[model samples]
Target chain A: MTPRRSERSGPTMHDVARSAGVSQATVSLVLNDVEGSRVSAETRARVLAAVAQLGYRVNSAAKSLREGHSRLLGFIGDNVASTPFAGEIIEGAQDRAWADGHLMLIVNTGGDRDLEERGIDSLLSRQVDGIVYAAMYHRRLKVPAALREVPTVVLNAETEDGSLPAVVPDEYAGGRAATRHLIDHGHERIAFININTLESGLPAVVERERGFVDAIEDAGLKLDRTLVKRGDGDAETAYRHAARLLDRKRRPTAIFCANDRTAWGAYQAAADLGLRIPDDVSVIGFDNQTLIAAHLRPGLTTMALPFAEMGRRGVARLLAGGSGAGVDAVECPLVERGSVGDR
Target chain B: MTPRRSERSGPTMHDVARSAGVSQATVSLVLNDVEGSRVSAETRARVLAAVAQLGYRVNSAAKSLREGHSRLLGFIGDNVASTPFAGEIIEGAQDRAWADGHLMLIVNTGGDRDLEERGIDSLLSRQVDGIVYAAMYHRRLKVPAALREVPTVVLNAETEDGSLPAVVPDEYAGGRAATRHLIDHGHERIAFININTLESGLPAVVERERGFVDAIEDAGLKLDRTLVKRGDGDAETAYRHAARLLDRKRRPTAIFCANDRTAWGAYQAAADLGLRIPDDVSVIGFDNQTLIAAHLRPGLTTMALPFAEMGRRGVARLLAGGSGAGVDAVECPLVERGSVGDR
Candidate 1:
């Protein structure tokens, strides 16, 4: 259901430039975030405000006319094997695009940048309206030279210098929510289990740990070193790490898992040790993978990362015309169910 | 990513038709399941055997050339909003497609046939190589007019006549496995929760129930009508249904849910009723949705539907000149976790 954009009329890029009292090229460069060019924050803000006030909309067809090919948005990501969130993001984007009468051409790059480049080239050969560099998580993004002219949005990935537009989940906030849930339930000894992965000199696991620690510290609770367990990102490793922590002399009453998959491993480990969840040891995980979390015996209480929302909004923004805007962050929501026990 | 056809020699559609002692049109009709045409059981088998022997391949590019777009495939139907199975199907198809030189231009029909037709039109206007009518479950499929000439493979869905290639989970085996697990654990008073939906008329679910009944009848166990629960294809309804069944005077020692989502709801119901899982009653669910089942407190033991494998196999079949081959079925494997318990 590709949207027919001619059905709607609104302010175009030229209109936004005119209203913002800036040149058309500057408006595009400033709004789209073309590399090697700098625009004052004040001017960029003015242009954005003008866009908002005038209800400025992007005519992907017009852009495609100028460039050739319909502005086919390219989403580069892995299949279900590597990232569970890819499907949701693609769905959200498709839904949004359908409403706007725009078509998106997605390519699964299989974790290879060269393949990603070739995919982008295919999209380019078709004269895509824009390109969306969406990954499975908030990992470091690598921008290719061929995509410079296209309006681009990086989904679930971070950009250097905040020059490229990116949309990702707020992992730190999600961790805080999980920790707060456990603390409010009268649990004093809490543990954090996370995978070890580095992204842009910072690990997603560490950031989540920081948020959990911050919550505990804010509550005046002691954070013990014995309570923190780092998994190697595999179910076996996570299960082993959790077993070691739970079988300790003074184990934490509640455990916060890095993600749903890791939480699954933790569940197996607990079951193997005959630890009843929420009674012997309560468990909470991040990223509410609907299928696994819901079907778990005592359904997993986890945070729902806005993967679909991020993909939808990112594509919406790109299609709506804000290629030059800096990264935008979406909040993750908590889905409470049966995993956590009442202390 | 779309895989380009191998420039090497391969068996053509003509080769399969010639070896099968059938007309080329007959082979296409049999494989595509054109209505108002009858393909004998023996003839269908012979064509498939010929295809297998010759190693014949369908040139998606050539097919698209005959029709007009790239040798791109289109998949309709999205269960991501409710079930996690659709993701794996797309993932499997996408991954296999990259190597086979065909790109799947997936359109999320969101479970609406009209929207599906629109998606079909969008694909056909561009001249697609073929179309794959993928359903979330194995139910009667209504062929759309737009799919008249496009080679199609129905996934988790079946037609009135078993003339088309279709891939579905082996439900009878899945049910047998679940029941066998419980029976081995010494459970006698077992209840089955079936999903009540238009598609519940699905042969797969029927086979599962048949298997369950067979196991119980074989054991000569008295089945209670009050214990059988039916969920309205949702977690909330499943919760309510499970609550009613579990609250009975003589609650079953074990329960089997139709799908993972239903199990999630049932888990919530059991928790709300203050019953400890496997202590009061053990529960098992179908469809091993890793994200949901694995993360549950007790971990859900379930049957894994081969969505990825089906998608991969479907694409492989399409490329292998099995495009018009009749009625192909794939097997679903079982995955055991902690949900099921000894009676």
Candidate 2:
């Protein structure tokens, strides 16, 4: 094949300037909103008309917008493939970015720090307007050093310094709401089944526990240390924990699980003890993981993490000139189902 | 703010040409791999050094490779958030694309037609090298008109007309493999539970069923029509279907479920009937949905859908200049667990 440039090449900025009888600098200023430009309205109109007539588009190899924006956002995640909520978060970001006529370049780090740094460098190389660093779970993390080179936001996780705007689920509220729901049902002896705090290093566990403590204290109920059991937040672990608790002489009439999996274990424990859900022991859970919560015999009443809303707000803030690196929390709505009942 | 180019602007082709003492066209030919260029090896070496010295990295908005390529691949999906394998597919594509020095622009359409069209348009406007049209499930679909404009490969789904390369799970092999696993466990009479065939319009149903039939016939076991049942592929439906089969005097020793959820339903049915899992009836399932399969009391043995492998192969095919519109099937490995027992 002959090495030749196509005759009908895409129109460049220079072509627009030439057709408009103006300098390329004038065209760039009027079109790209360069602050304090001296170009007149008539000349701007002529340049715009010429650009329209020529169907000019900034080529990927030589694009130089005066505002220095690429209209591209980088969504960097850790091990997104195996993470259940990764899709929801990406869906949220992609929908919003596309709505604003922008594109997203997604990079899943597979939880490697080197890979994450490389992802950030790649995003920078592409001149993305901003970057969103996200985690599969809600936890504290060390922000990647490369994030310092660009406007960055963290999602579903937080940085130690709180120097970047973050959008995280209100896990504390979710826990408090779960406990309160059981309390409202006239259950004075409500047990709390939680994931082990120190072992997990997950904010969800620490905040949820705090919320449980606060709610019980605020409700004028003395917190029962013996009734609070910690496990690995799995069905088998929860089953063992609940079994031991229910075997006690003064078993709680209601149970609030840190997560739906724990509630599932509680359900099994109750069944093994010849107890009926809600009828004999009311139950509530957090993070209304639909697969487990909805599939349980008596659909679990749990808290719905505001995953999509967090992504939406993150982008909205970035577009609204966000800075100052403050932490933000989104509401976790109570998803009432059939589990909790009156004592 | 003087409406002038930045002093530290990236060096352009002109700079490289000037440094190499050659025309800009010659530099472009040598660097971009334009075919049939008669440039000397020494001149090409000089241009390469100049390019390295200038640090001329291509920007996202104006990236241009030889043959008008942009080094950007579009990964367009429908309703990826709710899908179980979204992360696996994306991780495969992203890791593969990045390994080849290409970046993927992902667009999730939430199953909306207009949004899908807009996504295609957006990708085309950015001059993406090619597109990977992905679906959340394995089914036949109407190829978007915009797909006609670009080189495309469907992932996890097929177009009505085989006009594009597709990488899909071998559901037939998976089903046969599941049934064969039960047979291998010394079960002569095995029941097949599945999703509705015609109602679902999913190729998975038909293909998987075909494989089940083939395996049974190959085993010289008469295909028992009474042993085959179609349900909604939910626990409730599977429970109902399972109850009828268990009620029979000549019940099958094993059951092959369409999915892990169906296997869960079978477990419930066995429990309700006071039957021990491996002692009374062994069960095997399809689609190793970790949450359900691994969590089930006796982990449900199932076939793993090759989601990541399919995505990897799809990108590999596109990179290999795929356009034959051939459908490639990825192997679904049988994951052995405790669900199946020796009869």
- Identify the leading candidate in terms of DockQ: 2
* TM of each candidate vs. truth: 0.64, 0.86
Q: For each candidate in the order shown, give its overall lDDT on alpha carbons.
A: 0.72, 0.82
lDDT of 1 by residue, A1-343 (tens): 1112132334678888888999999888876577877888899899889988985644333333333344345666645444566667878887776666555566777677777776766665444557777777677656777666566788887776566788888878888889999998889999888777434344367678878989999999998877787776556778888898888888788889988778878887887788888678888988887666775667889988898799788877877664475767678788988889867
Candidate 2 lDDT, tens digit per residue, A1-343? 1111232256778899999999998988887678889988899899989988987754433443534666678899997898667888888887777777778999988999888778787787777777778888898888977677667789998898888899999988888888888888898898898987556778898889989999999899999999998988788999999998888888998888988888988988898788888898888998777777777778899998877777777776666655668889888999999999899
For model 2 the TM-score comes to 0.86
Model 1 chain A: lowest-lDDT 10 consecutive positions:
A1-10
Give the candidate number with the greatest lDDT: 2
* Candidate 2 structure quality by residue, lDDT tens digits, B1-343: 1112242356778888999999988987886677889999999999999888886644445435345666678899897788767889999988888877677899999888988888887786666767888998898888888676667899999888888899999998888888898889899999989877656768778888888999999999999988999988788889989988987899989998888788888988887787778889999988888877877778888899888888788888877765688899998999888888999
lDDT of 1: 0.72
What lDDT is reached at residue A31 by model 2?
A: 72
Candidate 1 DockQ category? incorrect
